[model samples]
Target: MGTINELLVNIEQYRLLGYAAVFLLSFLESLAFVGTVVPGALFVVFAGSLAAKGFFDLGDLFWFAAAGAILGDGVSFRLGRRSTIYFSETNRLFKPSRLARGQEFFARYGGASVLFGRFNGLIRAVVPFVAGVAGMAAGRFYLWNVSGAVAWAASHLVAGYLLGTAWRTVEVWTTRFGALLAALVLVILGVYLLKRFFVRRGRLLLAFAGSLLGSVGEAIITNPDVRTFVAAHPRLCAFLAQRFDRQRFAGLPLTLLGVSFLYVLLLLGGVIEDLLASDPIVAVDTRLDNLLFAFREPTMVKLFLWVSQLGRGTIVVAVALTVCGILALWRRQRYILPFLVTLGGSTATALLGKVAFQRPRPAGVAVYREWSYSFPSGHAVIATALYGFVVYLLWRRTAQWGQRLNIFFAGLVLMLALGFSRLYLGVHFLSDVLGGYLLGLLWLIIGVSFAEWRRAEWGPVSAAVPFRSRAAGAVLLVGLLAFFIRTGMRALPAILPANGAAAATVTVPAAAIAEGLSRNRLPPYTESIAGDKQQPLSLVVAAGNEGALTAALRSGGWLPVEPVSFTTVARAAWQALGGGFPPVAPVAPAFWAGRPNDFGFARPLALAGGKPGREEARFWRTPLRTNGAAVYVGVAERIVGYEWGLFPRLGADLDRARDDLVRSLAGSGVVAVSRKIALSPPMTGETLAGTPFFSDGAAWFVEIRP
Candidate 1:
């Protein structure tokens, strides 16, 4: 295989000859006895790899392979046709058992065997012979032969082509990055398989859900208040009855029990998959961590840092005990079983998964860290069980569908947010969170089902005394609603810049950098100048005065650029629609010093055919200065006219922008000296949308003449 690959790579001049080689090899592989000794699949795959590199067209290769296969089978069929009349089952050349098996296959599958047998390597050779001896019609045999060859050739060739592409991509990425990308591909495949499993078993799974819902409906109808309400309003009761009426509710208990077992199996499957690292859980987890790391800022850090405390070990214990107290106070002896099952089972499950998988947590300074293995995240499991059980309690208490829905979604949101908190705080991978969620949900299902069954067995008890006064409940509800409303209101303004050119600022401790500018000397600046979705600041400078720096940039033909906002973005779109250069383009935030760019500048361009483009640079004035000079770091990239897409998309070419900036500065003669410095190592990374880029990690430093 190595030699073949080397040969294909070295011989681009004779790529046209690959078509003939593919045809001849595929023919020999399909021929009766010769096919057994030949590696036809290997050669066809080589052809595919060649096709990938533009040496041969895959379309022509497929046709040639298919034709060769059909012809080979046809020749085998003729030999059988001539030889059968002269020979018997006792002939030395024909093994009676092999021929009998072929006969049996032919009898069972009829002409279809000709098509299916093509995939069974050894049997494929003999099937054509057996068909000929069986006196199958020549035309019918040819039809199946042609159909099977088409499928076989196309599938094998396509598989080879894809594998070839994957191999090359892995080679390139591994050289630039590491083994992470390769592992990620496996993880992604596993996740895709998981989704497929659910989809394929959707109906079977839905039956379990239907049974659970049916049980809940029965429980509601059995309530005394619900019975009284139905009696009082017969017409309304009838309408509701008609909507839910089903005769299949008779054997629903057994169905529910069966579904509960299936849930156990599914959860077990997830655990096994995770432990084996055969699922995309690990890859998804790593990639998600990388993605979240890209967007980290002090604001988000503070938000999640606070929210994550809800799942702390001390908090979990406190909440669990508090719930036990509430259950005792409510006089619900039966409800205690489910609460215990959910809480206890979740904790145990999480512990077992962690120990079994022995997966390590992501590396970072977490809000709080625990000295334990990190497979199933305890926080995710606890939230799912605790909050999920609360959902069940609310679900049982509320008869109205509207109240039930609100309760369900609220509990769901809380659980999801708790899981996200672990992810954002860099304590857990996505897999660990998912594993914990799955485990908790599994236990929650079994516990809730058992609780319902027990509740049905115990008969109705008198309602518990009110835990709090109606006024207190009202006050609590109002307070929660008000708090959420206020939170939502404040979220937008707190993070966004108030106006263009007002750089985002953060207070730096005076003692943080002894050799650099202190907090008192640091200029207020954002991480990047706000235009074009936060262009990153790649260039930094130290100048004695702001006036000199501004004048130097102006001499270099860099005009101070506008900050991006909703109004500016809209105006730009309007200008583009009218076929003109946009005055302003919105930039997405790129973080530095835990904030966005503080300043922006640009130079206009007119390309061939009067097309419009701009070379823009953004700078963030840092808290650090050199030799008592104010230090500013900036990045430059170019945006051509918007590319038409689902929505108009901005076109960027960073390398081109960098070159343009360099040429402009050199032409202006503003710099006394300029040199390149290796700021970091060469690396390959992708944007959030998966647009890949490579960087050599060089930065240009130009000292401006005072």
Candidate 2:
């Protein structure tokens, strides 16, 4: 870490080398044949990220990358203009099939193919070569080539820069949120990559599948057994054929919708059954509620409160009316009835489910008091139904597959955000939101099926509405937007007060503290995100508050772990990279009862050959208390060395670290009283990070002096 820091500090000395590296990478990434083998784009992105950290100039990096990209493409174009022999069928790098696909792409898009193809990895390498071979004018080729190179450089570099800038913030929040933010990021990235893959290869995949299925279908129909069965049951075969006919709405489309409806209906039933049976899901709900309650920030609460209001009854109804008005003006009135029914039915279902179940909203943890029952979340239901219908309407009107996909994903994101807001605000449990989604999906499929049937029966409508009617639709949309803004402003004030409320504290009698520890009134071990047991609790401390407890540890030579921030993180990295250990390095968080430890402290250790080690401890404040003092349960371990010069490697002797902490506190002369007590049987376990540890399960009970 220190070595890397020093290099970054003096990076200007190697500015020329950095630029050359960037130029070469971008050049190779765009070069035909070579581009297919090199992962230059990834390196260019990393360079941009380094620039964001001040290791290089962003402008310089951009120019070098863009220039290299342009020159590389020009060279590939020249090579193509010179000869056709190298790109034959037998050439492994430039196969005839790949070249043919490139030619097709170029023919379809013309010179703009250069611009469009720049972003697609496989196509990027081949398009320039195809452009040159087609005898395209030099002027037109460079115009598109330069435009593409500049745009590509800017986009990739900007992405990397943003990621680098957000890394510090993500790191800090990750400790607080406990993998939630990280997991969310990974999911979003994965979805984006998957979407891109399908957009690029979907047509080819569909064509391939169609051919394969057609062949199989023909063989099946030609079979002797199949012919005999068909001859015996002509009516049954006709009915089956009619059901699968793609041209009719009541056929393949309706069958698919029916299947989807049944699947969602079953899921809804399962959620209801689990609720009634008090299953493990119910247990998870309580834990999650408590976890989110502990981690709520005022800023986040306000943000989610605003998001939640998007699903308000008035807002959804107003938007629905606006959409209906637009549809009527555009001669899409056939869709209006189904659309309204979908939203209305979903809302009614949620309200009815609430009344039938009478399930109370999460108590004490809720940011705002909700008067209605929470068996099925109204916000989740409305968001799903309203946005889902809107997506369907837009998808139906869109001709381009890409635009349709974008509309679908946009609606999906909105529905998910609104549903998540309800969870974040503590207004509903997991089961409630899930049930609402399933119920909403059920209605959505019905509404879409009906709309499709209507379209099929009535034939296509080509009547274009007048300019006046279109203008009126636009006005209605603007009015709806204005009303939505007004409603949001009014709703903000109602949730503001609730955001200021503190989480309620629980107290246990002093006499019960020891017995409670033995009986596991609190969890006996640390927890992972999935609620699995991790390291056992091996230390307990009683203090008036966190301040006194930290003070005693500080006096005993234990330094509090630094809170994650850019400067602290950089400093820690520098130290670790230089093979020097910092006393107050930030520690990776461990959870207990779904919440990360409330405090962390480490005592530096000197080892053989002057190596650095530390005794690390993490403590969580339990609901249990002794007299008026807060009770804290903790796990302790020894950091033996650095793992890959970044993460701290831990020692297996959990008991030794616990003993060291007790001895340090006892010798500090601040202890009122302290004793070792058996908390659990001897056990072995691994931490959330998968570091193995063993312990005698005996814990120190330390009371701090007043």
| Residues 501-617, model 2: lDDT tens digits | 454456655545668765555677787644667777888889988899899899888989986444565677688788887889777667777667778898899877888888888
Q: How high is the CA lDDT of each candidate model?
A: 0.63, 0.79
TM-score of each: 0.44, 0.72
Deviation (Å) of 374 in candidate 2: 2.2
* Per-residue lDDT of model 1, residues 388-440, tens digit only: 88788878867665566567656766787788878866678776777777777
Error of 1 at 377 (Å): 2.1
Clashes of 2: 4
| Most accurate candidate by lDDT | 2
